[model samples]
Target: MPAQTGLRPLNMKHGWPALALLPLAALSSIFNWNPAIILVLNITSIIFLSQAITASSVELAAHLGELQGALLSATLGNTVELTAGIVALVHGQIPFAQSVMVGSILSDILLVFGCCLVTASYNKDVLGFNNALAKTLSSLMMITAVTMLLPTALYASFPIAEINKKVLLFSRGTSLVLLLLYGGYLYFYLGTHNYLFISDNAETDSDEDDEPSSPLANRAKLALSVTRLIAAVVATIFCTEIVIENTSDMADTLGVTEVFIAIFFLPIASNSTEGVHVIAASRTGDTDSAIRVIIDSLLQIGLFVIPFLVVIGWCVAEPMTLFFDSFQTVAMFLAILVVNHLLRDGQYAYIHGAMLLALYCSLVVVMYAR
Candidate 1:
């Protein structure tokens, strides 16, 4: 005989612990406010993040499903950092953001990867170097690193104390050209046979993550999906600005540079969701999800963050090129290159993970030294 507790599905499913976490994270955000709004936002963010993970896990039930959950986590976590950046920008705390961006970038490349490697070591083989793919990703990361030099170059080469029309034009032109070229390369590369060489995964492993149902293309109306995606992005930027503005005010009291604030705190803030998801993924042994979260953050940093900051820098009269001088850039470059090599073999072994974790640890030390 079965002992049945008559409870509603929602009530039973919406366990008290998960619900409790949201308020806790939101309240955490308030601690950062005058009376502290960080507490509220942090707690809400935590809550929302948990819901997102719950939703994603239910919707996407394979190992691959974990990817969406992890990405959701990263996105939420990064919001904190973004909030800080927006605050600094509005309040004219440029240096603080500079610091935060550096830290955030470093954290994405090293910390996430290291964590992934360490946990992955328990189950799979460490990845072997895929030189061709590694070199390609390394090249892009390097280019991005060099693009960071644009602001410095503009300052050093053109000699502008403030943002002149000509400088702005030049910068915008450079951004457009680089963006298009890189985009085209991505399209071609991903579409081409070269992708096969770059991406080496065991067929059996991939099957383990395959969806039971057909993909959502037919059921999920394309127009609606596009609109939802756009709305999500717009909303992210809006909320991010609010959070950034508040964080900047506190930075002065904390006595940290915007650069440091941007790098360390901003990431911790924005990546709130991702960090939690990573832990969740680790507990569940969802390696693919772990990998997806890492890649998603990198892409966001490389794609979204770079361009957004460039535009924001223009708005704020600061050089977007400040990213280059930070050792964080070098650290980012190293992580991507190393990862490409490691992932190329597709084995996903512990030693490879160890190597990655080791390098990440080393970079943290180097970042401290620099």
Candidate 2:
């Protein structure tokens, strides 16, 4: 029950660029055009589609109540990451998929959250959010970081083929545990203790802005929003497939590792929509919702998307695991540490934002040099 803001009408202008590129990307994919060209077209198209998905999710969320709306937004917001990860795994791109999971979490918590802080703190010396919720989310993030660390440590401790047999089993077992934890979390927050998260000011403001409308009109709007959301998701799935198919070629052409592209480029496109939504919430002086959006998304990716992927891979014979490389595991741990430390007081400033951005940039450089 985070603060609910007035629903801004879905902005089609933000999606115009994507609409213009949709046909070209489809044609490029169908005609088997240059891999780099296809990759670029599809990547750009996915970014635009991501924006549309976010806009529609926001509109749809307005029709639903706070708890259901938050769930819907979090699910739809991670659509790109989930879709891309599944497609990559199906194609046997394990490292790429792994990087996507790590990258999406990192980008949301560090890059996107950083931007939100900078924007929210621009006119003010500091901004604050719900301290209790922030601490809870930070604690969950610490658990996720630990989950990531264990598998990597296991892999390092037993590098022999004999010990390799236990890694996937361990990862699968951990995935099931993580999935259960996420379910408990949803029940805890959205069911038993939702009142703790709801903001009275947001509820009052939203009620003030509410306008009476006919049941028929409300139905029509809901129908349109659902249709728009479904359409964007389908379009994103198509573009993501195209992009995944060409990722290797694009990496080869650019002379970079697929892990590098997955970490740096893929997350930007996949998470751009969420980033925009977070920033908008911050700008509207709803820092609570803004922080919720970022933390919720990160939790969704860590607790839901990653485990879901691993489970899906288990079913699909892809044998995906939570065992990320040493560098990625360490980076994720450090990121969660930094974010938790900065957010412990539930306050942020421009300098805090700059620190996160600087760390992100440094990580990028290190990855490139690796």
Candidate 3:
């Protein structure tokens, strides 16, 4: 086994103490605490819960290989966003849910990826990853673009009412196909083609002597990790609901559209956990992990979350089609294009990161102007 380089420290000093805010948030909810204070507590609680999940999952991932580790991290990290979207859908906030899905995709690809790239730039002039894997993920996103754009295109073509059976059936059918695709993707990536995602430079160091923790300690850590995972999830569910409600109130107070809030603010709050990990990976010069974080999140949203949302909407008696506005569809396509351009070279630089951030900001401005 090649000598392994240690990853950079996570700089988690400030994050740990934020866990104190969780009880305060719950108390505020119970006691009718000041709305502003409650909001702050809730936000802090969410941040703490997310980081808690991330921290535990990373520990958990130490036992799993890179592929499984990244998948686990992405899945757990996305839970908050998924829960929030489902809650919003059940409340008949369909547009908000849809906007969040769109925003998540954009945020993962542009905002998260760009920021991680910049953090990486501080350590190296250029970072590279497995281009073949990136190309595969990019191709998947392009397919997703077509699938999402179909309902809107059909709506425009037929002049059917939005609530018509045709739209519903079309959405249901498309969602099923997407769900199948997601299943197939899992089998392919985790089963047949797993090697594509695993880097050649990876080091394997499994000497028995190198094991630092005792068996009892290891078991205790595992137990604690599982306990924290459940607690964080429960806490996150409550905090996410509070976040959604308070964010809506905040938006109304600020006179911004709920769509705007859903697109920009909600995604940032929900995605902050994964964003932190991505940046940390970049800072540690683990470009593979950073790319995996961004790309895996995007894949989960496109292949899994959107299809799941369609089904959840139907279950909640508020059916959601795969329809996105033309503008949003265009933005998605543009995002894919930009991502392809960046990843095609198999190298990343500060300038590339800057361009991505600039593009994401421009998209935000356009959405706001709309």
Better of 1 and 2 by lDDT: 2
Best by TM-score: 2
Give the alpha-carbon lDDT of every model. Answer: 0.49, 0.80, 0.73
lDDT of 3 by residue, 189-258 (tens): 7678877755433343223225678889988888887787777788788887876766656665656777
TM-score of each: 0.59, 0.91, 0.85
lDDT of 2: 0.80
- Evaluated at residue 36, the lDDT of candidate 2 is 80
Runs with alpha carbons beyond 4 Å of true place in candidate 1: 1-100, 122-127, 153-170, 193-242, 252-258, 272-296, 312-370
Error (Å) of candidate 1 at residue 283 is: 9.9
Q: Which ten residues in a row have the lowest lDDT in candidate 3?
A: 1-10
Better-scoring candidate (TM-score), 1 or 2: 2
lDDT of 1 at 334: 61
Predicted candidate 1 versus true structure: per-residue lDDT over 1-370, tens digit per residue: 0000010012223223444544444344455445134534543443343333333333322233333433443343344455555566666665665566666656655676667666656665444334454455445555665665555556566545554554557655666666565455445443463343322232434555455554575346434433433433444454445445555454555554434444554465445445555545544455554554555455555544555555677777765434345455456656666665555445566666567667766754554444
Tell me the tens digit of each residue's lDDT in model 2 across 1-370.
Answer: 1222332333656465787899999999789788788878888888888877777777777788656776776677777788889998888888889898888888888899889888888868766768887888889889888998887678668858755678889988999999999878887777897765666655776678798989999999889878878888998898887777878788888777788888878788987766776787778777777777677778888988899999999999997988887889899899999998877877788888888888899988888888
